[model samples]
Target: MHTRKEFLRNALVAGCAIPFISGKDFLAGARIDDFSFTSPFIRVGLRRTYPAFSFFATDSLGQGRLHLSPILTEPPRSKAFTARTYRDSISYFNSPEDIVADWQVKCEEKKIDLISRKPGAEPFEISFSRPQNHATVLGIMREGQRVLLPCILHLPGLGTFIIESRVPDATIFYDVTARESTGETPFVKLRFDGAGAKGTVKYSMRSVTLFPRKKKIHRIPLFDGYRRNFINIFQLNPRLGMLANSSSGDARASTLFLYAEVARVTPPLTKTFTAMDLIRDSLETYISGKQGYGHPGWSGNHESLDSRPSLIIAASYYIKSTSNREWAQKNYPAIKKWGEEMMRKDSTGNGLIEYGYSGNSGSWDSKIGPANWWHTIGFGHEDAYSNILCYRACSMMSDEKIFPQDEHTRACKAFAEKTKQHFFTNFYNPETGVLAGWKSGDGKLHDYYFTFVNSMAIHCGLVDKVKGKEILTKLLEKMKEVGFVDFKSGLPGNLIPIHPSDSGSKEGFQIYQNGGVSGCFAYYFIYALILCELYKPARELLLGMMDSYAKNEFEGKCPNTGMTRVWKTWNGECRGHEGFLADSYHALLVVEGVDPKIPFLNELVHFLNALTVS
Candidate 1:
């Protein structure tokens, strides 16, 4: 067996996910609890009133709550965190109980500073300026054997900061991590077990003006301004093994629509979590039919009927990304259960999973929740949106790498083929040359010229390539005819307005899925165009969104509803909630996922070149 030392040596170089280990065991004797402090946003525990200890954070933004645990610590060069250079740095910040002799602490309204001393040397001080904005900042200064230096830093969402270390001869490594919990114990509640950076946000400084070196130590993709805000929106949470809609707390983690939006993007970090762990948790939650795991993550809600496809797609992505046949071989039985449950949804054998609700006029409110992710509209009974995801899910589950070549896998393949054969004929609205939102149980075609319904069908190969191109062309013409021209705000969910009777609530037009513009679904339209090689329109829309992202318009709240601007109005009014919705930036994946031949290209000309766009 390889020793723990051997594992650390390999992990440090690979940036691989950290395994669960006992930090308490490694640094028990080095701990001393001389000072501690707690707040709703942050809690700090220091050893010897200096920078060596542990802390956890929980934030309640509005009605939602998120817990972060096992936040990074500076362990005294011991078993779990045995990097001599790290433990010897003047910037080493650890647990509050990690008491070092001859250390002193001072507190102020917005600051707490620590100082360390030696008999014949000058005193060293480290201070913190508390969170005063959307993000917290950390300041670090180096001397000898570790010391506390004061600095002001702001971190968004939870209580977070950075302690960067540098030794000229060695690579500075900070084990930054965060763990999560749902506070409920479902049969599949996957809580993080041990310690050593849970690897959520990587905290660091790009540059410190006050430091003597004026150089960066931490290359963190923690919050905003990194990878076009990729880490900020889709950052990891170890306990959930998924990204919540936002760190702001408007929604919980692993909401199916949000999770599905993440389908195309690979896991961003490999330091403490894996996409396999995420998929495993989601599948377990799907089987258990629990609520808090995320919307549609659990199958118990008859009103929210996208559960099966969402679960299937997430799991398939994991298999495809990692090519882990071992996992597929092990979880084949559980995977079959989900496939069977989905097949069972076709009560009529019509090849479409018939939702429980009829989705007829004025029939939405009396039911429990909206049919799928577009929760504002009442979609049910052979819905195009859900069916689009279903067709893809069934096809993916039949992949040789995903499921074994059993009778069940054959059934999945048959289900996919049957769904495709019936799909266009079932939901096509010839009147508008586009797919309808849904076909209700009352034998009605609810055609609103839904943008996402058409875009997704075309994007996913549910519609023939030629027909898909024609449909997209017609949709664009319809968009122009409807006088919708602002690509920066994104295209509306649909062109024609729907009657209130078919909507989840009596929301106004151009508001909250009645006809709102959100990046979450717009990505499908742009990506679909790219798939078709319709470069001009795709580049135009994609670039417009890039401008909006640079200006930070997709996030933050509107003055009117106090809602986050994840979803917006036609004229650029913020109408939706979830102040920092993670799904809103799904559009960013269009740029990140497409490889045109340049590395980290950001200039408009180069970005277009990278995209092969003229």
Candidate 2:
């Protein structure tokens, strides 16, 4: 086996470095935290956060139309693509109702129904027959229309589809045909072959035209005007996304914003709005189910209907702090509905919320061993954490008048009872006096002690003060015995190994998956530590996590990889160097202990104000 010293040496030699933006550029555009100088409204470039996909930009008039052909095209790193543009096609700043109204006005004269359908649990299906498919969507001819339709065809994530068209639809042609060079300006002809007939039909368009008139340029006031350009560069760097992936380093960035917010509550941080904006954005992204939140990601690129109640519960806290009552009302109903619908079923027949789905692990994704199978098979591990969150949401609903006061109280009590019954009776381990991670299919404990399980108990308020402290101490001991951190106090670059026994001894190696540490886990884990008042340990873990991302150069930018500088675990390979939102967000949580931060209070006000104006 390769020694740690040799591995670090090789990684340093092979280390990929991102060039720092110049000082002239830095002062020209510096944000409060890091270096990034672009506005959010403009298109920096297209990037697939996950690998195996490429993004290219196009103009709506079919002019700059590229990548619509059969073979997928790659995006160029040239300045032409990087230059910011006032593209406003995919943005959904306006409420869904307003967007539907706008779409209705535009599609009024079309032959189609032009109805708006929300993607609930069921997926959306669009099918057009040949004769009607040839007809133009609106009275305005295709070329005359001002709207830019981004026709995205995914070869991997999105499944396949069959298209049919006829002769009358000559104006309607597939964007693929436009790729052929017509001597000067290139254009593609649309022709299709069907079971019986072949004619003109345009099924898919391959470009996106950002209507500059409707779109406006805007940026979060994260920095002063002169420092903006430098700040914009960091926005384009994938590191921020990775920082979001940084185990506990996120606390530093988050703390800055929280401190800034506490400093000025009115105008807010006029320099960069990302601090608060991202929280709201994270809230919306997580709650909407449109963005991936739980591990294993979305199944087949489709949004999983399974709602993480904890996310909604956390959002409620963030929202309540901002005093955005209107938003609470607007989102509360959906939160409740999703909770009622998607949560896993408990023994009491009340909905039990569970995280993870198919592809989450072999327990669900593949045929794993019976122990792993039982640990994941049912709705037991989800008890306290899930119900506590639901209780919090219920309490908020009552406070916000989103639900009837009596109903809310009744729901809370019901959930509380279910929580006590399920957890105390089922999950509690008498031998250890701690909650087990999972209650097996046989209803017996999986008999494993996990920090998460204890954290969840604390999060749900199931453990008393004394028990909570004990649990926290045990978790820390468990962390140390497994060799979780290195000499420099850097994380081991993986998740805490779910040790097979309390002794943390090498009785068996089966339980060690990612014993290093996890970025997202650290976010909550640190919070657990803080609540338990394990001050020194929490500080050590937090500072260690921060230093792991620390470069000799910059103060804030975190390395995408933790434990070591290598980005990937594949022989400690390094790919990109940057930070992520999680790093900043977690930082906010940590720094708030030193100082309170009401994240996105102004954005909440702005959104509420806009709604009132509308």
Candidate 3:
């Protein structure tokens, strides 16, 4: 058996290193504090405290609430004021009409400043003027004669200032404002009056750190810029193992796909054992049909095809990415069972799984829509999306080097290729030059130019370069014609709108899955574009998505509740039910190369590329 040091050394040589630390040390040092501060733009935590006026009367034993409000907005109802705790301090900021003033807290010292922006921009302010219009008030009330030192920190375009109580017996009240006056550049002003304290006090603004300082950082590989922000969203809920589908609940399959993808790309950033445990547990839960596993009422529905495909892909990815052959061998039985279950779904023997009203569709529960993941669509009876995933999963499992070389493995390999060929033959819409969303058993096609299915075809190597390029060109044309702007909201799932006649549900038209843009589905399309060598368009979409994510805008609103993390839909119509959808953002790591040539799950990409060429 290899010693711990030996194992680490081996891992280092493999270009990956597992940290050498005891479980206690790992928990104590690497664990993220749950009580960290968060905002639309950032999150921080408090490590220490300084002397401050107490907000409670004698023997008060509860936490004190600090309320902040932007000028021209109501105190509690305004969406402008967003805050979150970090490891060493708390971060608070007001983003009103796109003008942001990020405040950083460290112990008792606080720094506030406005983010610089382009002149005359729609999203951010050009100049800092009109202090009263942009002013923000920080307030805490207590019954006492205690004076609050430096009660307010004001940030104007020109400079920073503070408002404080000059008399010890005065109540604390102050306002921080930014304004532009005639002939003078924009500047900040402090308005003070309450608590016998009476005048504005000018102070110099100093540099402040907006992002939290990491005591022990785990750097993610293969992505940068706003793309990295996706990882930050995942970090927010570290204990959950799988990314929280929303603030309140965890969805299966899609969540697993996100976690597995992240782990595959940057193993160091993920605890492999912990992630595997979560995957195994979820699979067991699905298998056992037991309640109290957080996914109740889902046991009886076998038609919900997403969990099986998602599990197969995730498990295969983990095995390949980490080269953990032992894990693959150990879990081969369970993994094979999942693959067999997916294969058994192909009642037609034509190598595509059929979907019906038996259970949920893909990642979406039945209530959402008729089809799989694109829940609102009428896709069923051999879905291209689920089949593509099934093919990939089978191919990964059948790799002779990755698994035991046996008749079952060989059959799986042959079945994967057969499925790929059938996928192209059945789903390709020669008339539209794109893959049809799904082919019903009744021999009808739900052809809506589903962007995700086409993209996955290209990424998975089921489509040739010429065909892939043609499909993408058509998709771009449709997106442009529809007035679909940057990827802030994410790429629309389908190019053409779902017609009410084709959709069984009224919610399928121009809403939710009907044709609404979903970042969750966009990742695959983006990856497909890159895989097809559509460099310019791919980069444009990616950068546009990143810019949108940074702006954190939802609909026409400046910042929605899900802005802090990735939103499920670009339109911001959905909230906690779909917030922090990690799979959408995790797509960034799928592409890696000077011009983004490589696809995610590098080994799988290599395998599929070779298959296509051959």
Candidate 4:
């Protein structure tokens, strides 16, 4: 199982190593094991051996707590006799950074410098007795790609440390050693670094001196809260000729959304390029086929062909975020193709697009179905959400003149009309004001209400604002009736009450029956409500959702539901491998709404403050 924590660490440290593929190549020999720490050296041809770590089982709180077996790589048989080894000792951290080291780091304005002093082989006590204290060396690791170390420092009571380093697309390295553990005299070593590329190393004085240890091991939660949120933000650098992640399969449209988010705010970051520029470059990668459409991000994973909508939304956000006219012109063709081929109607009189493969229709799931699964038996159709998303995409395309003026406007309007006339007519029940999943030929509604449907509708702006509001109100009421809307506790996964419709069964909270209150629903629920302007209810629901996850009953992480594993109903236990997106997504909403000028900043502020306090 490729868990989020493990994947996150892999992305943080060595995302550059993985080969980017489109959605189709999901079944290729791309093993998740390639990301494991077992292979110490990620041989990118002549690339140097970079230090790396893996994430595994952790203790209680979420910290990097894995006993990574010493990483090793295959050696040529010719040099087998003189085998080289690689290993890393245990790591630890504290708030103010007090370990065992006679090192000092100073930070004023944006400049950061570090000075280290170590006696040659002699103990600190012996060296102190000498008139001229022993050997001392100082080095500097500056903002550019430079490292100056092994030097000395003659300074004052500088109780603070600052980190001044910048890299366009490079990794950083820092290591420290200390001797002298026993002390009520806080032997502090101030160190600072940003969330993106700041990698550092420190050893306790006791560990260095081989002194008696009080605790066998300890791992402090150094980076916590929302500061952790931006870890991925400032580091969204896609490698040339390669996709960054599954999401970056098409770097172009993807950057629209990514940069849109980044361009909205200012923070303590070093990178100079705006999010818009990155988005533009990403689009170029997609258009040039450097990102290879079909395996990971393009049309590879699942046959849904719905990534066009994601691409569309990303583009819309990018345009809205930066108002970049030139970028909109350069990458309009790919965006147009995504809008047309992915969602365009068939000229053969069929109700769907040509090669409208309803392969697996999920963003995260890796399952790939047939090129065309005859929807003879299912109630809900595959491309319903796709249609809505395409409509929005076309609307944005037209707004940006990505397509010819008349063509884009006509395309957008036609798709909107067809989506409503053909799809919504059957699935939506205006009487109940709910967009059911799909309508059965037997005239019965199947999957009458689904969070996926609701989320997509709200996200794509397909759901009518007023009707959607009423439906959401009823959904919340229904959720409360089923004991799934307890604000003091956690919210349910779906508001339809996944449990038995009977009142007696409704007493239990977080239980699945009608899709139950899931931690994963936390952000989706807030997103829907916020988009619909249901502030009070959205706020209440979000708090309850967070409280539930804090308990960890759902998953070791948060925002998951107990659906597929249990009786498709009843059990409330669930965990998500990719729910971190929920936090970021939710943060975007909470922060953006409080201040529309800045998307999801309140949440970002909260996350940063929590991290600082931690």
Candidate 5:
């Protein structure tokens, strides 16, 4: 282990690889099967014949630990493999790089350059070096349609690393994925695949650290549990800092709302990737007229109605977190244009955003259409979920730090006020003291007591505090009334059963999107409760959910059912098909201190007060 000064001084000497970081070395009982380097910052174990068997990290206090397995993969992704046949000695990097030459992976600023050779009469050459610490930089170089490049990086509470590179005339067949391990431990697989490509590719990793708070958070079983088996659902890129719909490849543009609002993510590795990169890419995508960053923009390529607003919020958070006015000023024109496009969705001039579909019962077409993120719930026409986001987008767009004091900003302010004023009348259910999920095109209210819809409205300040409290009270009552005590699994999407005719899929009640339990919206409910000063209920909700996270119940497929755990039945059946849903962790965001503009943030104070029992 090297110190901060040594890291900056001689991180690399000759061809030997070594890691120098902020703190001292702390290795007590770590089992090492191969040549390994260990320190408070990062640890790596490498074998002469194959890729690194272990890659891990720890915070300065040595409290938080991150363990990863860096494996090599080729096409078909049939399995992860390493170079078993190699001519080499167990020569370590002077510090910790260039393990045995002949084969090598270089972590550069712009790209991860990779080169491997077969040696015998031919000497097999390889290069493996750890990049900066706390970050995982990954990339895919594709000039055009010829390149089907794929790369993604993320850690539990830490964020993603970014890499953007270009190589002309080189067919690099490689991608990177952080596959969650099947066993109970946090032994995740980070694969950089270069299978049968003719040319060169990229593979590299570095470490960065976000030191946790000095004072321990108030004792809450959930936070400690979640910290143990943390699973990352946020899949980020230049285009969109999205959430994974499943294990890999599929991206959900709208689901990132929580990542932006709750996590308020900053860049983990600032040298090559920053949170602002997502904002820039979003502008580029909007300029190119892409409806949404996710190709599964199931609804007319626009993703869902929430996409634009979600992106807007994400960008706003970046600006808020960074206080980067210059970036905002430079991009305001495109930003303003997006605002205008979003407003145009209010074709009726009723001050509420509208959708293209009729949203009549059963109007949801799973393969191609839905008005919002909950694809199978038959939400359309006038949607509460969409409006809640639209309200937030307009409210944030009017910020002086974002848009200049122009007519566009004035319009945003006015629209936000109008939305706030009309929201209750349009969506609140007088009988239930809660809001409905949506208003159908035929002028009908579809009220299933959707937990997300009401919670979102309340937390976004669409309703007054008094009304918010009333709604939360009613929601809690309904949840208990329905015998929905399975908080360990997560709160149900709706307390009442989704109508058969309204479900997009044939899946019955208590299944995916049909009253299924998930953290997707549970966080909002708990936060709203805390905001309304209902502390006990909020604490209870949080503790219950923490039980699930500690057990790693949210992600990874179940051995028996073989179904994913992010979404489950009230009775604990695995109904979700996606192996993992990152948005499920959004429920834990209240402790992250959500957003500054919202009054609830002050109530949260910090992680310490987030779960204080009253």
Candidate 6:
């Protein structure tokens, strides 16, 4: 049990290492033994040896709240250890497991623990175990933390390994060597001098392997100079890859976007086989009429209109990124079927898909009805965002020569062109000086000057250069007028607030998709600004966003959410059903100019030129 003062201090210092408590118990009457501090990545359980002190730690996967254990390996032999506390010293007798000798530990509040196996001899000890100091040195190494160790083990066959057992800032000098052995177990004699003291330690080791040491050679020039600042961003792709692969075949917009973003950056890091498996499974779901619609929460739903297009886009991206022609060729028929299903949405032959009164079909999941992605507002019928994605998907599939260049490919190309033209003509709202979010069957524009819709149009090249510049400039001006220039809170989803009356769900203004700033949506806006050559504003917003991430300000605004990852909303409100919408981190790479098509396109051009020369 931690004292109230100690608990508060640990809470402040631990950051994500605090265990997430959901019930009313909340840390009151909580025991250290009640929680299992296991690293999800390594699947290793961490236990505190003394159980009196707490050390905050995170696993390789960044899942924090792990306890530090003094015992490194699960030694083969176990011996009972007794702990007794005295006025000046706390001591432990016997060995917890088969080391070379049993440990007699003397713990004090102000000084390092004096550990000795032989009585009346130089006491081997560990520093930085003082209760008042909270510097972490014993637990598993997390990113951005200095490495410190209490012991170093040298096995007969294995190399020497540092064992973290205590938090110490002082330098340690070790003169230790492993004894040559032909037996199953090996022993090592250890002596060290540190902090103006000399000591001897010993260890017996079983078979163990050390963590591999390798120098990471970057083959891509994407992060040549800005490596250190972008380390977290680089790590984010693999984390997103895990989430994308763990979708259990649901394949919703959130999961698809996560997969697409990871695929865009580095294909091998992504779980390509798992994603392809899920995509194939999702195709069956779509065919079975179980997933074309949308559902609530993280579970598979098909009610949303963008779901089908999102799957196609994700698959196309996977193919383009991985150059997995076999997967594409094998699934070509299914892919065409999915594309045909998307085309069925555009019943009017106008190239733009119309949302029936069924609901909003975009990505924004609101408490209201079936709106598109911007769920709160009335973005139904023909949505600018979904249509742009549809056009992009169509174009990607048509350009993909992995499949035969037949009538299906020709139709896809033709449809993509039609979608582009129709979207530009219909979605743009000159009255609002930006693209309309959606246009209904009545042909009236739901023109709220949406930031995402307009920016995405620019990003996907749906809007021409002149129109894109004008619209983006107007958006910036409006955002400035609405006081989004400071961006202290977050980038607004829309320049103008969504009126309750105009919203299908009657959602109030200035909350969520109605007007709330979304970090996920803001990425496209920033990318669009870069495309439009609005460098100053783009650079300012990009730096501001990075600063927010660095200072953890995004989660600060919405403290109740307990969001440690890139959130869906800029203010950290979990809007996308899932809490960590990993795609938001994709914004960081966009400033580096990550275009998934460029490499593939370059290869295609080279191949074509070679064929022509031949």
Query: Of models 3 and 4, which has the larger lDDT?
Result: 3
Question: What tens-digit string does per-residue lDDT give for candidate 1 at 1-614?
Answer: 75533432332233222222233323332344324443332334445433344443323111111233333444354422111122222222233344332333333222333333322212232221111112322222122211122222223333222232221221111111122255321111111111123211111222111111101211211111223244334433323323345322322322454454454454422233333444455555545554443254333256355656777777777777767788777776776787787788898777898887788888767334656777667787888888887788888888886666778878989999999889999998888788988889888999988888998898788887789888889988988888777787677888878887887667788887778887777778987787666666776677566556544567656665666676788888888755455667677666555444532223333433333322
TM-score of predicted structure 5: 0.71
TM-score per model over all chains: 0.64, 0.45, 0.57, 0.50, 0.71, 0.57
Which lDDT tens digits does candidate 3 get at residues 1-614? 85533432332233221123222222121124322332222222222121111110100001111111111211123233344444444433444343332333332223322221223212211111222212221122223311134322222111112333334433332221222235443322222221112322222223221112222111211111233243322321112222344212344553465566654443222111223344444444444543221122443233555556777777776666667777777778877887787788888788788765422223233343443555456566777887887787888778765677787778778888889777888988778777888777667667887888888788778888788888899988877877665554676677676766456555644455666655665666777776667765665565445444433332111244422333334444553233234455554453431132353334433432343344
Which is better, 2 or 6, measured by TM-score? 6
Question: Per TM-score, what order, best first?
Answer: 5, 1, 6, 3, 4, 2
Note the Cα lDDT for every prediction shown: 0.53, 0.32, 0.46, 0.35, 0.57, 0.46
Model 3, residue 384: distance off in Å is 0.9
Candidate with best TM-score? 5
lDDT of 2 by residue, 285-348 (tens): 4455443323223222222222344444545555645656677667766656654543334433
Candidate 6 lDDT tens digits, 1-614: 75533432332233223343332332233334322222221112212243122222222222322233222232222433445444433344444443422243332211223344433333233222111111111111122322223322322111122343332432233221112244322211122322122333432211112221112212111111112122122111111122231111123442464445433543221111222333343434444554322444432233456766776777776676657787777777777887887888888898987665533323334354444555556667787777887887788778845456789878888999899777877977767688887777667777777877888888888887688889999988887676555542346677676665566554445555567654556677777776666765764565455444433333212345533323333344444333223334455455334354434223323432343344
Error of 5 at 76 (Å): 17
Candidate maximizing lDDT: 5
How many residue pairs in model 2 have overlapping backbones?
52
Error of 5 at 325 (Å): 3.3
Better of 1 and 5 by TM-score: 5
Give stretches of model 4 more than 4 Å off: 1-271, 276-278, 290-302, 345-382, 400-406, 417-423, 430-433, 438-445, 455-461, 486-524, 530-533, 545-574, 577-587, 593-614
| Residue 491, model 6: Cα distance from true site in angstroms | 2.0
- lDDT computed for candidate 2: 0.32
Q: For model 5, how does the per-residue alpha-carbon lDDT over 402-490 read when each residue is reduced to its tens digit?
A: 65678988998999998888888999889888899989899989999888898888888888789898888898888789888656687
Worst 10 residues of 3 by lDDT: 53-62
After best superposition, candidate 1 residue 450: deviation in angstroms?
Answer: 1.1
The list of candidate 5 runs beyond 4 A from truth reads 1-89, 92-100, 103-214, 218-222, 225-233, 237-247, 262-273, 291-297, 300-303, 594-614
**Candidate 6 Cα outliers beyond 4 Å, as residue runs:** 1-251, 267-302, 358-368, 488-490, 504-507, 555-579, 594-614
